[model samples]
Target chain A: MAQNPNRPISPHLQIYRWGPHMAVSIFHRATGFVMATAGMLTLLWWLASIAGGPESYATFQSYVVSGGEEATGMQVAINWFFRLLALGVTYSFFQHMFSGIRHLLMDLGAGYELKTVRTWSIAVYIAALTATALVAMLVAARFMGA
Target chain B: MGNGTKLGRVRGLGSAKHGGKHWLDQRLTAVGNLLLTTWLVLSLLWLPNFDYETVAAWLAQPSVAVPMILMLANIFWHVRLGLQVLIEDYVHDEGNKFATLTLLNFYVIGGAAFGIFMVAKHAFTGAPA
Candidate 1:
């Protein structure tokens, strides 16, 4: 096949007006990519740590859940950084999942109308936020002995 | 000269015949992921403790291990399908696209295999002491 160097390109970000659906669609892809990469890696590390016996598992746990009681200021800062990353991944998990459900519904011949699309896009965000908050609260309660 | 019209030629060339299967598999795995991930999140939240021993014991149950293995498979399959679309869309060079996709397949398969093995070990032998 001959390449068409002068072929017209489809309208993209610069040419198109931004909207809720567009943002949601882009977020779907972005979150999918991040989860597939970083999320999967974290999962693998966790599983491997479990399989590696207590010493290795403890090392992983220290990095993931605690900063080590004797750690210096810099180590504490780094521990908080990892905690933030874990939180972000957790949020992304919920967001990506809700968006995935939205896409599946659209594939099943629903949510095509413009109003419905807009409504569902916002709804997905709201649902993800709610789920993330619930998860965070539950985790906090568990950790705090409540 | 051929008898077919230009429009017919265009239509014939555009139908790759395999696109539908790819699209269908992606959606199917998405559905699976939706269900499986929900179970995962809820189960994790329900666990009394988050320490390594507790979590490992939780995963060691037959009930937990089986579903977890299923979830791992579904997750990796979905990741592969999604990443394949991404590679096809953005990677312009034919060789680069092929190489990237091949590597992606390896990554997903290897990761899934390792995950399943770990889960199965725990299920069979109980969690390491």
Candidate 2:
């Protein structure tokens, strides 16, 4: 099918080096998709809990808390699985939050200058990482204390 | 303070109008997420030992059932609003933007309905253990 000429042309991802705005935008979608899937996973877990008996429930819980288990069922440690999932989710959450704040600033019509945009973009990255670390540490502390 | 300055001076209301409303809604929904998530976390913590029957009984109560239903609806609605803005920004085609928003609205509403239907069925069915 012929591409519609009426569409405004914009550079695709492959055409240019990735930059902060691109990162922010892509990460927003990435996190959005991740959380959406996570939401579904959560709902499934709830449904399974409602449907299953003790043994099945234990199996499900095992899937959730497999972090410290030896075998962790099927060669992968549940802890590791959770860690990776948490990292992605946490990263996405923070990145989205950072980008969101940036968007909010834009809505207020602040940070319009090039210098301001660049500074905010850097701040977004820094804040996202910091938030990610904070989340990870909290999760670690909670699980460790338990 | 020229006349242009005077008109500009008179226009200095508290907010730009409508912007604060959107901002307030976003914040309220976020606060809802925080509270609902706390409940979910606490419930999940308590849920490890629960059997199917026990869990069902817990969910059957209005306390658990209603909050959950509300949370589910609000979460999806908030997501719809967020994605609506994203699509509006990125999807340049006017027709495409409209279609996406319409599709997103249906998705959110349909998901809420389906979720409520399932929760109600489980809540009222009184399935035998």
Per-candidate TM equals 0.90, 0.60
Count residue pairs with overlapping backbones in model 1: 0
> What tens digits encode model 1's per-residue C-alpha lDDT throughout A1-146?
33466866567678878888998988888888988998888888887787676777787777766767787787777767767877778888888988988888888899799999999999989998898888778776778455
The models' CA-based lDDT, in order, is: 0.84, 0.68
Clashing pairs in 2: A66-A79, A67-A79
- Which residue pairs clash in candidate 1? none
lDDT of 1 by residue, B24-112 (tens): 99989988888888898888877887777788888888888899999999999999999999898888787888899999999999999
Worst 10 residues of 2 chain A by lDDT: A67-76
- Candidate 1 local lDDT, residue A90: 80
For model 2, state the Cα shift of residue B101 in Å: 8.9
B100 Cα displacement, candidate 2 (Å) = 9.3
Docking class of 1: medium
Give candidate 2 misplaced runs (Cα > 4 Å).
A1-8, A43-56, A67-79, B1-68, B81-129
